[model samples]
Target: MKRLMLDGPGALRWEDAPEPTLDAPAQALVRPVALATCDLDPAVLQGRFPLAGPYPFGHEGVAEVVAVGEEVRTVRPGDKVVVPFQISCGACGPCLRGNTGNCAAHPLMSSFGLGPLGGLDWGGLWADLTRIPHADAMLVKLPDGIDPITVASASDNIPDAYRAVAPQLAAYPGAEVLVLGGPAAPSIGLYAAGLAVALGASRAVYLDTDPERLSIAAKLGAEPIEGAPAERVGRFPIVVEAAGGSKALIAAVRATANDGWCTSVSVQAKDTALPMLEMYSRCCTFHTGRAHARPSIPHVLDLVATGRFDPSPVTTRTVPLADSIDALLEGPVKLVATN
Candidate 1:
């Protein structure tokens, strides 16, 4: 089997590797049919992230169940499914509480494809075949009518964006949403804004410095603001910070209405300062962490299957697996590679 291996920053190659086999009755083997570039991929490839590679490089995709172990009953050979980025056992205390990202049964941050952060032993979705433990718990069968490419990011980005807005909107009921977008997780920001609109937010306003991001946001039905405002954009009950810098995070926090909630999906490698006094005065709730992707997969799939949400517009290009290396090097907003 051959898989995409990240030799170093901006260096990748197709390398032959041993095929993965199911070692446990609860495990399964899958062949990735559609792989998407995670927003973090470019950073990892470009050396912007603090990671040393020479490991399998992808974590988002839809796959075909090539084989299943005896204990796997939810799916069988030939079933198409969304393989979550994280590796988690569904019976742990944290998983039972809906924190699959912090499942007590696995090492902290045990996942696929981020090298050390995500266990290297688990490999990546860019491979020909990968093993998935806790098959029924980790794999979400793609709904019959949904296109696999449209929800390729359902494994991570879509669910990350979904968490940034859906629950907040549900709690606030028809309130407006504010999305701060830029380099980090750009597609996630667009997805968040789009979900807000599709889920019935009174209005979804997206702020970003990049014209391309603003354009995509507008196409997703959100009001696009060209430049970052000097002060608060507007008081909103739900604010999402998908932009990477401290400036954007500050803006997002300050822009929240009294008692509002602001969820940040950005990755900041260093410890940064925050406006504690303002948050104290505003009484805002701030949340920032890794997305517990598994539990949200089914809901996101339902959104796509029911025609309530469409994530296809965010995809910048579609290329076959052979062309994935070039597509990944180009680093578009969202690139989906089909096998």
Candidate 2:
């Protein structure tokens, strides 16, 4: 099998690898039908995250069950399923609480592309076929009537966006929601904003320096605000920082209203300063972490399947698995791999 391997910063290669098999009684072998890049992949490839060097390089995808382990019953061969980015055992304490990203039972658990969690580095989904542990717990079968292309991004970005906004929905119904950044973040933000509106947001404002991204936001029915931090602050009740840049984080913090919530989806590798006093004075709530993708995949899929959410407009391109690196580093919107 040929898989995408990280060679170095800004470098990707297609290399031959061993084909995956049913590794455990609860595991399954899935051949990817559609795969896409997450917003953090480029940063991880550039050595921007805490971990470094060539590993498997993708996390988002929809796959067909090629083979299943003995214990797996809910899914079988030929089932088209949405695979979440994280590797988790559904019975873990954290998973039971809906925090699958922090599942306690899956020791050393991590996705195919990312490095191992507790010293077990594994390859990612950018391959001909990959092994999925605890298949029943990890894969979500796609609902009927959903386009594979449209829901490909839901494997990560869309659900991530949904999680970024979930915590804020109850506290700020019909409040103005601000999204910061471009690319995946803004794209996810747009989906989230649409969800917010459907759930009753008064308005959704998206800010980004990229005109093209802002244009996409506008197409999603969000008010596009063009400018930098200084030009766009103090306007939204709930601000989401998806840009992964310090400046964007600052903007989200400043733009949020007093007693508001700022959910940051960017994976910041370095330390950043925050307006603690200002946040304290304003009673602002700051939240940031890896998105609990597994738990949210079902809800996101439902939204896409029912036509309540459409991410096809945000899918900028589809490339073969061989061009994974270039597609990831250069695409404007979501990039799906059809291999």
The most accurate candidate by TM-score is: 1
Candidate 1's residue-wise lDDT over 1-339, tens digit each?
Answer: 998898888899999998888788999999988899899998887778878878888999999999999999999999999999998899989999889999898899988888988878889999899999889889999999888999999999999999999899889999999998888889999999999999999999998888888988988889999877334678899999988878878888889999999998999777879899999998999999999999889989988889888899899899999878887888899999998
Tell me the tens digit of each residue's lDDT in model 2 across 1-339. Answer: 888776656777888888877667999998888887776665555556555656666778898999998899889999999988787889978888988887787554466676543223546777888888879998999887876777787777888788767668766667888887654355676666666655566788777778777777777767878876445645677888877667777878888898888888776667889989999999999998777788888888876777666677677788776665666767456778786
Output the number of the lDDT-best candidate: 1
lDDT of 2 at 242: 72
TM-score, candidate 2, is 0.91
Location of the lowest summed lDDT over 10 successive residues in candidate 2: 114-123
Q: In angstroms, how far off is 48's CA in candidate 1?
A: 1.4
Q: What is the C-alpha lDDT of each candidate?
A: 0.90, 0.75
Candidate 1 CA-lDDT value: 0.90
Listed per model in order, the count of residue pairs whose N, CA or C atoms clash below 3 Å is 0, 6
